[model samples]
Target: DFFWFNPSRLPSPAEWVNVRRIRVKDAVDPLWWMSKSAYPKANNRRVLEKYSDSMIQLIQNGYKAKLRPSGWDISTKFQKDNGGAIPPNLLQIANTESNSWYLRECARSGVRPHPARYPSRIPKFFIEFLTDPGDVVLDPFAGSNVTGEAAEATQRHWIAVELRVDYLIGSKFRFIRPHPVLAVPAG
Candidate 1:
């Protein structure tokens, strides 16, 4: 609705595979998980239970616990005191965005930074989130095959499909060294 040039059209959008169980030791811990802390929320369950064991606990105990403004602890803001890991934005006090969060990474010169293709981090986030090592990720509309590169980076197997041969050919650059030098024929 806010497009200035293409006012009639739209602008967009990861690479998430369907959910699966975690059976491998190498399952991804997520960038956020790695960046901050993971185990901190464990004590939250105990805190809620400590309020009391009766249906009338809130009425009886005077509500010792408090919920965040949104009242959904999963997107939590409660104080967890069990020495667990801090949340994703735990360290960075200033970077919180008001609307939403997006993961971004530098793209290769040509394969992405374009409307048609996506940054590898887009695929990287999902590959790490939904699957483990050796899990298979399939991108039906591969575009420049960013998902394939992300899969390889995350140690997951990947399958890509792009109807255009030129895209497929260009996609190969993703696997190559960032910059390569080829020799010129002798004149």
Candidate 2:
């Protein structure tokens, strides 16, 4: 995949007539879908069918079709609050360590290294939704660089930024090439 923030490009779903948007943001969270909504998993179904059919076609036609969404808009405001939601007490945790550590370790060893992959489909959907082939997609806090991988998989250019050196160095997957990072501009 091409990893670039400013120079490269991503893809737009307009390329495929099959992909369409039927509704706007859900009422509960303008940015997310309400689980109780009738079409809560609308995009998911379409994505699955598209990928499944494409996989089958690739096996028979000797060519693979890359499917991406029409737009790429990631918002962090709508996430559910985890402050008081977590269980009051668990088997682990000392007064010195933050609660996040337990969850982090659980995530690391449970299934995938990054238990929270943020769903590859989400980035793939965004890359497809907001851009066109070769268009550049920039992700400033690209945790795990999933966006970069999704962009590359969709043939779009991707650029990612992450301040945590350990996440970058210890990542199990390499979706974006590492460049010498410079300091952020001072205000």
Candidate 3:
């Protein structure tokens, strides 16, 4: 339901202004501002701070933020049952973990972990919000296949496609058993 790109690669402020101008034309709903996976460098922090300040100003100036009418009742019910407010788009998950199972498995097997692996929380958040328990999830760029792990943990069926065989092999550490269906191109 939500599309997210890594925030580390966001353009500088001047460029982002132009980018926002273009995005606004096609934007129908609120822009969710997700936090970075890792703690941001000073420059990136400054950029985020500026953006946050601008948003605060807009809100103080009486910008009327609207929730989707269809989901309003559902959101209220979710909040009531869950005893927590709906998560703001500014996700605060930390991407770095020195001793995660994935890392420990890679170390045990002497296989290097994927350099660009994102934390499972990112996909887990969206999956919980957007899909029901039995839905099918597809992850086309399945680096370390964290999305697959998250989907399976949430009782969703998943298909993950990764071009790199090494990464795909390593991703298996997250699963209890080998996938029932395995497809590889004939050499």
Candidate 4:
């Protein structure tokens, strides 16, 4: 779900694969919109604006929409006595974390950090919202296994696959005691 190119360079809707027609049972029904966080860069403003507009259009087109605060707002006067709020389509999480445990471990081990490692909050948010405990979570392109770590913390079984050996090695540091079955064998 990560896109490396700039928003302006994104593929047009016509050029992209249409998976909307695919049917799934209730067991694995995906949310109407997949939530994502983006870095607040000046160059990305136009793209983000357009994306937001499209999301609004989708809602107008009969897609269910819900808005949730990214996290707790201590100063807010309104309080919900029930469950946590529903997450919004546009996630406002900051992606910067130069001093995280993963980064520190990578630094201590002399391993290069994944350039595009997203904040754990991003995955944790969606996982909590869309899935229940004990559900299986899969991250096919797990760069540093942030999603795996979040899933494990939330009591969910997880599978993380990485293409690069170096990144896979560094990702192991995220776990306190690596599970034998999940470990990548040395070549």
Candidate 5:
């Protein structure tokens, strides 16, 4: 049943076989004041310096979640001003109030960047595609354990690993049943 072979290892329809992504709600932190409270508007630089690590981690991890940049209209612009080739995928569209900026601010201010969340759909898709009814799935970097929730919904066993203890505990709310948690070895 294999129709295509992608030697480049790019994720393609044929290579995936049954694997796919799922849909879920955006997990951005609901509380907004924390950003300002921790890093006052006046002392933006100070805040940025303090929580720089969190910001870097967020930027690095954002790509894995496939959070396409929001707020640009390339099609509209191409009609009026033609300068550079329009990127086919449009990884990031220009938006004034960008998520990247917000995340960077949050990371710099030591405020958790409203937890850039993944939708349940993402994990659901993967579970349905890659696994059968009883097969197992693993989310090694399970932030809020949304993957576990999706797996549960689709009747697939899941193993979600998170370094932070609080997230591991909070993930229980999202899942109907709890899957066994395994400790990841420290590098």
Candidate 6:
């Protein structure tokens, strides 16, 4: 993530904040055993660039992957209805370093903001990539239940647990309708 955002700071970047996002998923379904690395992205550009500097540099220089793997050998071996999506390991999210968005959302919904919370995109990305409709997503260490919001938005069942009831209650803002004062007028 760091390398992708700041390619100029290569070799050894001082960035370490994004390293905290570690997700583990279990594909208990027997059919998904063979495609182990299919959804769970193992590494980011930081690690990949370190492992293969020249290879990643080629893309950094200008090269881009084929929009779809069609006509490629891999496409022949494996294919899915969502094959058009080229899953990228490197994530580029802006304004996630702060909970400003969450705070604003809380105000709009007339609720308090949790002191600490992750962006909904974090869980939304993983949930969309790893699970299908109606799957259950569990956030064992749910801070403000952002994962639960993402799961609910994606039409999945979710269970979120937090040490404090206040924080869990604050997460309800994610589901509450925005106040009329904050709603934008139709153009």
Instruction: Tell me the number of clashing residue pairs for each predicted model.
Output: 1, 22, 0, 0, 19, 0
lDDT of 4 at 44: 24
Q: Could you estimate the TM-score for every candidate?
A: 0.42, 0.35, 0.52, 0.51, 0.35, 0.48
1-187: candidate 1 lDDT, tens digit per residue? 0111222222221113223432322222222222123443222221122222343443444434655588754322223333333223111112222221111222323333224554454466556655677977888888767789889988989989889876776677667652335545559
lDDT of 6 by residue, 80-108 (tens): 22213343555444324444555677676
lDDT of each residue in 99-184, candidate 4, tens digit only: 87778888988999888776686677656755678977778788989999999998888999999999998898788665779888
- Candidate 5 or 6, higher TM-score? 6
Which pairs in model 6 have colliding backbones? none
Q: Is candidate 3 or candidate 5 better by lDDT?
A: 3
lDDT of 3: 0.63
Off by over 4 Å in 6: 1-85, 96-102, 105-112, 178-187
Ranking by lDDT: 3, 4, 6, 1, 5, 2
> Candidate 1, clashing residue pairs?
40-85
Query: 54-85 in candidate 5: lDDT tens per residue?
Result: 44444445423333378543332223222223
In candidate 6, clashing pairs total: 0
**Cα lDDT tens digits for candidate 3, 90-169:** 65554456787788898989988888777787777666665678977788889889999999988889999999999997
Q: Which runs of model 5 end up more than 4 angstroms from their true locations?
A: 1-114, 176-187
lDDT of 2 by residue, 35-128 (tens): 3445432332223222345444444455323333755342332132322222111112112222333335436545234333344555675566
TM-score, model 1 to reference? 0.42
Which residue pairs collide in model 3, if any? none
Which residue runs does candidate 1 get wrong by more than 4 Å? 1-64, 67-77, 81-115, 178-187
The candidate with the higher TM-score, 2 or 5, is: 2
For candidate 5, give the lDDT. 0.47
Which candidate number maximizes lDDT?
3
